[model samples]
Target: MKKSKRAITPEDLTKIEVLSEPQFTKDGTSYTFVSTKINENNEYEANIHLQQLHEEKSTPWTYGKYNNSNLSFSPDGRQVVFQSNRSGTPQLWIMHTNGGEARQLTTFKHGASNPHWSPDGKYIIFTASLHEDDDVASQKELSKEEKQQLTEAKSQEPLVVSTLKYKSDAEGFHDDKKTQLVSYSLEGNTFTQLTKGDYHHLFQDISPNGKQILFTANLSDNADYELTNDLYLLDLHSNEIKKLNERSGYHQRAVFSPSGEKIACLGHEYDYAGATLTELYIFDLQSGERLCISNEWDLQLGDYIIGDMRLGASENGPVWSKDGEKIFFIATDRGSTGLYQVDLESNLEILHKNDSHVFGFSYHKETDKFIIGISSPTNPGDFYLFERGSELRQLTTTNKEFLQEVFIATPEELEVTTEDDWKIQGWLLKPYGFEEGKKYPFVLEIHGGPHMSYGQSFFHEMQLLAAKGYVVLYTNPRGSHGYGQEFVNACRSDYGGKDYEDLMAAVDYALDNYSFIDEDRLGVTGGSYGGFMTNWIVGHTNRFKAAVTQRSISNWLSFYGVSDIGYFFTKWELGHNLMEDPKKLWDFSPLKYAENIETPLLILHGEKDFRCPIEQGEQLFITLKHLRKEVEFVRFPDANHELSRSGNPKLRIARLEHICRWFEKYL
Candidate 1:
């Protein structure tokens, strides 16, 4: 008899290693990627791993406690370059492909990251922070006393606010430091500042001929007031820069074609604000013409779905085919992200179709094969090798041991019909060791992003709830991606309207169909927009016995001025600024309905969360307490909005414990 798997525990999260940043060598015979694992000290440890196509196992290329990422293979396939924080600040490092002592490259004072190799492998381009007063033209290092003065100046307490975006969630208070493109030459072991500006410049790609570099920056005089990124091309020889596109939109992650004739990128206009689907665009470097090739395709490009687990990859690329005739990327459709390909003739095709999420992928033209990182509810992300006419083969099994020891609940797909005749897609996770006749408590989990989707990706929080004997139900409501753009935009001007109904309809559909669920013992929770919905749901109805809101928004009126993106996000998401329509903002705020909330609620927030700001949660908690309502507030120190996902591991585990305890006490 086979042994049954054990239920998953919160600590299991620490044991699972996340793999990402897969890069294929020029020969296409081997590949490299990054693996990040949490240590006993509750810190993330990252390293690079290499795997040959014919080999059965992958070997670690770099071993240490320091963080390392952004791996890129050299054109000659003899060496690899990546960014590391071993020296207390991120810097570029290069190592032989065959594995040997690594050599540190650049040692910039402000730090350097996102290393991109020139096509010839003679030079490396990266982004480094530069102060406004720093002279880039001089190319001189700061004196010891000057460095001390700069440090003391930064250590001052009071902040002199000048720009509208003076604070950021990832980077706390804004400084005079602006990220600019810089280059390092391997032959001379010298550094040169490529671009000079007060605004931040993000390096995108290097042209095939190595004569130009592609990057994006908000060069507008009112950059603090505008949230726009326009693509620019920099000539390497003359240092001349020119704008590529004249349209008003946010363009990012652009890459040069293999032939260096065209550039492909992911972007969108502010037609629907934050809820607008990201479209793929192709720009002709010669004619300076740009066209949205995916305009006809309604699905959103790239992945926006967020989960508690530490996801390794960001949105996959717009990689051009070796012939430069086709561009490949990922698209979120109906809750799953799939690989897609588009040709110059506007021919769109689904290269890889599945119900699971493809977090990252790389295609090597020499072999005409693809290496993909995929994850599902039952499987944590792993690398797989795929070819056009062959079966997919799992290349790396980083989480195989964890899967063998834990019983990950596989969610059952559900289709819910709302009163507005919209079909809402969702999933349900039955409690571990479920009994056919027993009535198990249920929890309705909502995802944030109102723009993101709740898909087939592995979610640690939902799995933990299932392991603790709760039927967890989560859905992609109307405002979510994967559906058509029309559906995603449905909840923009109308918050807590059809979107709330879509969530409620999901719960109703589950209770009516699932026989093992205990409708009376119900719980609800979500974060960010989902947290906002949880607050809204409790105020609107007492159906839920318990609720937990994390990093949520309670008052749009206050959120407009406090949040990092508040000023414009309020106008973008709610379609109203405080000055334009304060009444509408007040009407949509969940704190306004605090008096009606009867369900026991737990408010969890991170102190340093500038995105939603801890004030949002504090306001809601105070209002409910003054009303003598059932509420509890839990605050985490030195943590940001990403506490649940990338915060301190100990705090993340504690958050899970808090949620489980809150639900257990009330339900």
Candidate 2:
């Protein structure tokens, strides 16, 4: 792994990169971010950069191959608006905070997005999607071959179904446009619409005397069976709006408070459904009252650490503290994600605890100085420089020359305990060029949000399965999220039971406290719910001498009629619902023990995975090739279920070369 540093190539996924939205600059002495990577046409680009706390490199303020990203900065920070898909899809542009040529602001036709400004910058605000009877100043912009003949004349009409939140593995079948809230008017350059129609608002925060605007919707006229999210607010000088949580719950990111008379948010209510635990509140706008300010906090606030080098959006929060009596945020606990604060009498503090993965932040509020962005497990992230009486300083080693040319590995934490006495935290790694008494071949690796969390970030497919020599591990077990809210609702209605006994007690405590782990060369893998726990661990134990799985499921009664959130994520993680529970969702599915799989699996999926949908990998590759076994499948095509996170970068390097050639052909 390191005679001269090498291992870590799936084409280094276009040379690693990522950084993210950070911001700061209303005289906080400059800052901006974005970065992202993978492009020599393996797509995904992202740009913006900036920096200047007396800089040491960080300049590219928006360059080519599109993806500029939601920027902002205006109130006397002299201009910069962002959100680009360069002339094609995402719109709003505006430039010049000390540089130039960016122009174009809003040429509608269902484009534009999250711009924001107004603190008297003569208003900007943004967000687009219209069609429930259009009209953001009559939605114009067309020609790109008339927007491909109006999307081939609206895909030849005839499609009308109602909605159970009409399909979304990030936009696939929902099309009544929704997502409103506009405004533009940089001194009447015109474009008004501020909130309208059939639900979907989202934007959040604009107040500090910009006369109100924070958002979140669910305008419940049965907002498609009320999957809650309320919080509203609106006013920008009397367009009056109001409604701020009488609580149903699933409140959202909110903000507004450096004396805008209170706001701060992040919500929850679904007690343990979707594995609940999100909390943090505080409301008040002239006496609406509220206050559950992390009611005795139990962690789980933001960044649910699942990596694949991020793509733009950060600044999770409650945010205030410019003497608004403290607020700040970013939570998840025992397996990383730090920076926290609490104050309006609740008193909490931490402000950057370690074991990394901070994910994004900016805050300066007159010298409390933060910047943030962290990530670790040997760095796939940077941007540091905190300050509270000094020292947390690192500004950007943006992967220091791709870490002096590769070889990462690290991990090692582990823990273990579980046959219900509980413990389970995890890490492991070891293989890359290791020597200490040979053995090796271990794998494991699970993470796919059984409520997301396999922490200490930076996981290039667990460093390409510990540089292909294996022994990787991973863990967080019981429905994950940094373990709280009763162990993340202890594996919901027990699918594959108690996160399969905390992943076979961390693989029997990594095969009895690791003696270089061979334990019969055990390899396993995972993807969505770690591909349904590698198809329920090769259909209930064959002690994995190689399995793969990827966008899996292997049945849950046709994943309650073809998953796009499988009809309420199988009654919020299998408590039962396809008419109360068809044989307990086919006795906890993995294709009901695919005729007791004898392990040599492989599967992998994502042919536009609408949340585990390549017919759940063609029904486990045609029932393990009709019981002949030793399966094989693959697929990928226009990828989804975030094909190994943020899909399509050469199919995420052909999904890590098909999970490292199916664990180097059976470990």
User: Over all chains combined, what TM-score does candidate 1 have?
Assistant: 0.97
Q: Which residue window of length 10 is worst by lDDT in model 1?
A: 134-143
Clash number for candidate 2: 3
C-alpha TM-scores of all predictions: 0.97, 0.33
lDDT of 2 at 326: 88
In candidate 1, position 255 carries an lDDT of 94
Candidate 2 local lDDT, 1-667, one digit each (tens): 4447878878887888888888888888768888988878788889988888777788898888988888888888888888887887788889888887889878888788888888878888888888877777767777689989877987999668777777777777887888888888877688888888888898888887887798998887887876788888988778888888885888887887887888888888887878888888888888889888777777788889887777677887768878898888888888898988888888888877778889878888888788888889888888877888778877788878988988788888978887658888999988778888888889887888788888898888788788878888888888888778888888888878878878988899889888888888898888888889889878888878888888888888887778877877888888887898699888888887899999888887878888878988898889889999998898978787877668888888887898899788888
Off by over 4 Å in 1: 1-3, 135-156
Name the best candidate (by TM-score). Answer: 1
